[model samples]
Target: MGESAKTEETAALSVRALDDETWPAFARLVEANNGVWGGCWCVGFHVKLGKGRTAAENRAEKEQRVHEGRTHAALVFSDDECLGWCQFGSPEELPEVKSRRLYEKGLVTLPDWRITCFFTGKGLRGRGVANAALGGALAKIARLGGGTVEGYPEETDDRKVSGSFLHTGPMVAFENHGFTRTRPISPHRWVVTRTVAPA
Candidate 1:
């Protein structure tokens, strides 16, 4: 079977927290999808932990962040292979992210969580991988007794932005999943939220 066929066959995949044993596969996924975020390893916001660091250094820091449980980002997987990732956690837990203009909006006065980044393997883009990842994240959040989930997606008129930089995801993706635009940080970015009522 071809790659696309293999992906389709494994579409019933699930999301899980990454641990020491799974780090290598997760790192490979980020490296393979680096084209999406310029080889970010989803460290755009976590770079503050080691400012002025080289990409290699920042990557190591991010790996340490995951291993230390200082932050939490989920990995999408088919059996044991990593296919994608979603970064989410309390914004304050990510000092670099809090310093960005993207999060300056007054929306986060309280302890709101941020879903700051996403990625899928090169051949896996536009196949609803993100939606599946979001669904898995939401379920994970719910199991944690839930809290408000927020994202800052770009408001793009043209869809040609590179995937590496498109971590915010399109507005439609959030809207489709019951998230609403709380405000627009810029013409190209929006603060979207889904408040989970106390249970």
Candidate 2:
């Protein structure tokens, strides 16, 4: 992609805190982007409900939690059109994620925020859309005084697998942004972090 295309795409994609008015389209984007997590609705880390839960139920539960807790996640939009999402917040804010063994090690003591899931639209894939979204998130968090940003990016040798599962983003992308692996939870899953020291 051309630098202009990247710039144009990045400009079109605005990252902002989640709100009531934007949740519907955000949900629709996730549902429509089948390869990006198969209609997850970004509820994988929010709901206590199992994978067996219906999409509608999962969606409602996630909406309820986000509304009730005031837990904010980063949202990517092109003008009024929603394109992608990245869930980030204090560990306490995402109880389901915080309570899981996958996140237990080295998590209890750190006061940090988590970047749990990401979803980008089919048309917007491989366009540096996620990097821009991440830049937006980092800027927002830094402006708010700074905090640690962490994510579990899957490791893969094949670039084809990288495109198919872009939600976790590529480890190289995170590394390019200065994130380093803190620990490896599994062969595919690794915990990476970057601390934004207070200004």
Candidate 3:
């Protein structure tokens, strides 16, 4: 590939905030995952899971939220194709934590935003898409005037876990971006945070 082509390829790894105009790309990424979280359409964090809710219903609810501009995410794009996304919002927006008890153990500070979940396209693993999505989310948060951002990421310590289970993303993803652990929210998941400054 020529230098310009290589540059373009590198440029393709970019981040954009989720909005109505960009919803299509986000939907495409989720659809590729068999509707992510069992056709959740990325609403798993926004609302509590019921005993028996249809995937279509969940999808509709999610769409409605997005349509009303009540959704948020940071999309990672490779050229024109969205390859991954990291969901984020205020603490009230994503109030539930996987391990509620542990999360409450060390609540020294209240957060302005929470990094909840992530999804990377199939066959695009190990391409740094998750990291890009995280960077994008942080950039967006900073643009939102900068504040405390929280995340619950699973730590890897010689034990292997599937990326699918790491919906909140890996520990290193937050660490590399200046996040510090506040407490262990689960056996492998920890509550992490970072304070960003607007660019």
Question: Who wins the lDDT comparison?
Answer: 3
Which is the better candidate, 1 or 3, if ranked by TM-score? 3
Instruction: Show where candidate 1 strays beyond 4 Å.
Output: 1-10, 33-36, 49-52, 98-105, 197-199
Candidate models: Cα lDDT each: 0.71, 0.69, 0.84
Q: Tell me the TM-score of each prediction against the true structure.
A: 0.82, 0.81, 0.91
Candidate 2 overall lDDT versus native: 0.69
Name every residue pair that clashes in candidate 2.
none
lDDT of 3: 0.84
What lDDT tens digits, residue by residue, belong to model 2 across residues 148-195?
878778778664575545466678767887899988776676888998
**Candidate ordering by TM-score (highest first):** 3, 1, 2
Residue pairs in clash, model 1: 36-163, 36-164, 37-164
Sort by lDDT, best first.
3, 1, 2
